[model samples]
Target: MTNKKDENKLIAERRSKLDLMREGGNAYPNDFRRDSLSGQLHQTFDAYKDETLREEHIRVAVSGRMMVKRLMGKASFIKLQDQSGQIQVRVERDSLPEGIYQRFKKWDVGDIVAAQGELFRTQTGELTILADEIRLLTKSLRPLPEKWHGLSDQEMRYRQRYVDLIINESSRNVFQKRSQIVTYMRSFLEAADFLEVETPMLQTTPGGANARPFKSHHNALDMELYLRIAPELNLKRLIVGGFDRVYEINRNFRNEGVSTQHNPEFTMMEAYRTYAEYTDWMDMTETMLHGMVDALNGSTLVSYQGEEFDFGKKFMRMTVEEAIEAYNPEFDMARIRDREYLADYCVKIGVNVQDNYGAGKLQIEIFDATGEAELREPTFITQYPTEVSPLSRKNDDDPFTADRFEFFVAGREIANGFSELNDPEDQASRFRAQVENAKAGDDEAMSYDHDYIRALEYGMPPTAGIGIGIDRLVMLLTNSASIRDVLLFPHMRPESFD
Candidate 1:
């Protein structure tokens, strides 16, 4: 047959099936009264070991999508899966009306149905339902993926997530845990007196973090706007407007590369507190995360990717210089002040260094290459160089370093916090330096916001702020290896229509 003829024939067959269903009744029914769920059935039968037919005589009205069917001439066994679990249904021709039985036989594996039945034990001792009546809830035109092998292709599973959720049990569990983790986090924050607030996702100037922003044009204003890379500046603006404690759990967009750890768009949680420092933020992080671990796992210890991690234990603390020394004792901190020497050392270790960058940038390169992955447990590497941390306050003892800390776990950076730079003059100078870097072809450098500087000129309070990558935290708590595993619908390339 020709391609066009085959297509026309398939369309005609689907129309005929639809017409038959319409004649029987509405194809999709409105009401399905489910009395007991699959999980509830399991709970009710938990104590019944010796299952005689008498104890299993309680009738249940259950509704679910038909997953599997074993049909005989006079009787059939069907599996129904609800949200909680799965239960088997036994339908005999003598039990249901002849017309309904005929319709049940016509039902496919993916069809939704409601069944009124009594519980019973099979010869294999599995708990099942003996159906007295059955009704079709919705007809599924498309066949489900294979039952046993499932949608095994990673790309296909991501692209067609509904099919993946139907066949793959593990995928559903990951998403369920993701929801639970977010709920626990929100409760923990609320209990701690943090007021959750939302800020604009699209902004005129993206000043929060050091990354390229995804730009969009505003047709109404005939101007360009950017999707926020982070919500730090706006949340702090709230702090300046007299909100002492504030947080936002929302999406951030970065026009950058995608990797196992990186996504073009992802969720983040940022919080700011009045009259606090990076040290206080570290303690808060430990407490919040330890509480989550206990709530989720009933203990502070969690095993992720073959390593045992304990969140309740005292987290290791070290300065950036100290971490560098711990990892590479041969390196001298005094020589780190020399830009040429630092640049050569960074190049030797395969660190990217621009010609205009100074010793501070080179030091960050070395830390990323050697120091970050050395951290296996929860640890805070503090006191970053002032040049690289433009928005952080300079250390009182050493003006060259900033009062900043980054939390690392399992060789990845999880959170960044700092005592914010409240000095308007100092902040202006730092912003100027960043502007120079941007002009020199540093696309990832932050833009200097004059309005933010003006807000600081009004004498903003001493404050501390932190941004935690929510997806990464979920990955850690759920023992998921990839960011894509935690995200329900991760970004993907568009498929070709042809």
Candidate 2:
């Protein structure tokens, strides 16, 4: 909590400063305009130092927050940083009016200012601007973080992202890359004839993905609503409505634990295309990911957490059974129906297998615990057990497995796609099973949605759909290790209760 006295004291000081500025006839003038950016000026005139001509003089107006200041008796050197880049500003007492130099000396580092200056090269061969006049646009009351040390604390960086962006150059770059990656992804889908669509984020029944929902009350209707866990059900409805190719890049909310890989609210790009299956989605995933890597990294190869991963190379494809065999050769696949044997194996491997877990669920838990992290490169783990993949189409050869695949990179699941289950009866059965599981123990279970089943009954096309974790992809492209690094303002526990 803020102390009232301290708050009042700060407010009084700011008011006094404003009063003095207003009396000087330039409190908050809005007449200044910037003709060129700091970076554009540097790029255009950086090479004109040696062959100086009278006609080569360039006058540019630039505005930015002062980042650094070096003061001398009569002349001073400061660095002005705009959104494009930074340029050195050389201010001299002789250049400005008598009292203007003294006023400029009182300006702090974070104050926003506009300067009309001539471009030149400094003694150190650096591009600079020699300012003839400087106007203070806005004064920053709070002090910025130290220039050399930076905001090293993770919690503070996430909570106070503005400060983080100022002190940490890498943080700004990560967000820049994130924006570029999303823009490129949108272009890729649009070029492929996929129509971008919007879906409801709040639904009465949170269906589509197996996850716990954050619930809220609708005061007018006196009813309950859920923040959507996934936009799968509604997006598929578009398929039934004859929009064959559609995609949505949006946020999904889940009431879940937070980890380096997970956030309560995260972005996902979900798309559906008619007449395609999981195999078609696999090819699309590889091509799009390779393109993104090329755009950001200039190569398909990227390094993450000490491992070099190649996105361009053919991703390794394997079934769940194949992964199981490779990891545990001694496990008897024929005897997988034997619950006791599976339970014992789970205990040995330190998997949290509940007593209610059947053969398929236990296998998923074991695989996630042991095999997931071992997949360091891009690989598609396909043919997931049907019990855990309720909304996916069952394989023709084996009813126990689904025609699904999850793309893994850097030991993390980045994308999930499958041949969607379009059969209304089958989907209803699966939803029943998921509801039973939710009642029994699992909180992250799909809810029974009758409307979604009705939509399925109207005949959805045989479609292939995918949901790619956008934040995680941004992290990979930006070489960011934590979820917080890419997110500008990730959620955090309140530091003080008011």
Candidate 3:
């Protein structure tokens, strides 16, 4: 394909402008003083009528990219957009230097400019600034996306996030809300006596969760490390070290497939508290979510992807068996524990049942395939089978089930919590079982972490711990349909951007 020459011509023109700017003054000047945001100026003066605004002569200095421009013979109307929002600027020929006025006419829509002017109302009742002085702050080399069309291609949006953020109003709002959601969560945890902590992202063994990890090498120590799949194990060690309550909000890496809901790297909030059970975490989860939803939307009700969820209402609670039965009433309940029956059923259903896998694993597989999708409300599924919960304390009355609970909303897991396993001997045995699974070609199985077991020897308190995916939480709160929407720069295939 031949270059339309439009792009090249645009680039060449901007280069000429850059050279001209250097001759006249600095092409990229840093001395411009911006005393106000256009959004705030609008808010402060919007209430004033034309007569009041003109009488008060409210002078303000603002800086932003020129988003819209209409040049007349002796006057021009332009829209300048800053971090806050857009403001209109009206520049008369006599208001600025003759040379500067002529140069401003040639400036492109993407050019950064600073304007000092008096706030006034336009004939159409739109609030605007009558520019007394206008100076080019920075020259934009390339043009932005077409105004009416905007940036709508999803792949392009993720790959070139800066362009997406600049062109799309909703895109910027989503990220702004994402930051707020994280801030709200951190404050909530901090106020609850949870000390914010940081754990090593690089771990000798990724033991926290049964997820495949991305590995790296430490050259100095000649040791291999894995990007932590979850910070669970390290946070628990802090509990053993006498921290009563702790939380970490950071990144976790998993070697996994990408989807609307799945990313190789994601943010999460993991917290642990001493002397608390799985049930306590459940209550706290509900409370925190309720407050956050209110903070974001000013209500207990949250709407995501066309579904309404009542966060303030009491979350539904159920055992794994009860949840499975509720969602799949026709499923044979006896097959959940019948190892041979489940093994044959797994083969018939074309689901890979790992070799020597017990009925407990099969039970979860059944729930995942048939039941998990039906949990659309805030429901807590408790009493997870022991085989799938190595780091969780077993239920006192039932050896086969652990005191674990996963909160779900919109048919996806939102949070997971449990009473932690602290018995050194028991934990060692569980680790051994995982090692066996890993040996048998299960890459997602946890490793037998001797050091973590050694930490358990120091005796972690009766603790409740939970990890909530921050990306998904933002998705729900912002009504963002995909994980990529919340992430500013989601992973994308390498692309040519010229």
Q: Of the candidates shown, which would achieve the greatest TM-score relative to the real structure?
A: 3
Please give each candidate's TM-score: 0.93, 0.95, 0.96
* Each prediction's whole-model lDDT (CA): 0.87, 0.86, 0.90
lDDT of 3 by residue, 156-239 (tens): 789879989889999999999999999999999989999999999999888689999999999999999999999998999999
How well is each residue in 198-229 modelled by candidate 2, as lDDT tens digits?
99998998877888899999999999999999
Worst 10 residues of 3 by lDDT: 1-10
lDDT minimum window of 10 residues, candidate 1: 1-10
In model 1, which runs have C-alpha deviations exceeding 4 angstroms? 1-19, 49-57
Best by lDDT: 3
TM-score of model 1 vs. true structure: 0.93
Better by TM-score, candidate 2 or 1: 2
Which residue pairs collide, candidate 1? none
TM-score leaderboard ranking? 3, 2, 1
- Put down candidate 1 lDDT per residue, 1-498, tens digits, no spaces: 333443565456555776799997788778879999998988887456535554647789999989999999889999999888888899999988777787678778887889997888777877788899898888766677789898788887887788788888888888887888788878878887899999999999998899999999999999999999999888878888999889999999999988888888899989998999999999999888888889888999989999999998989999888887788777877886688988888878888889888877878888888999989999999989998999999999998789999999999999999999989999999999999999999998989899888889887799999989989998998898888888878888986543
Clash counts for all predictions = 0, 0, 0
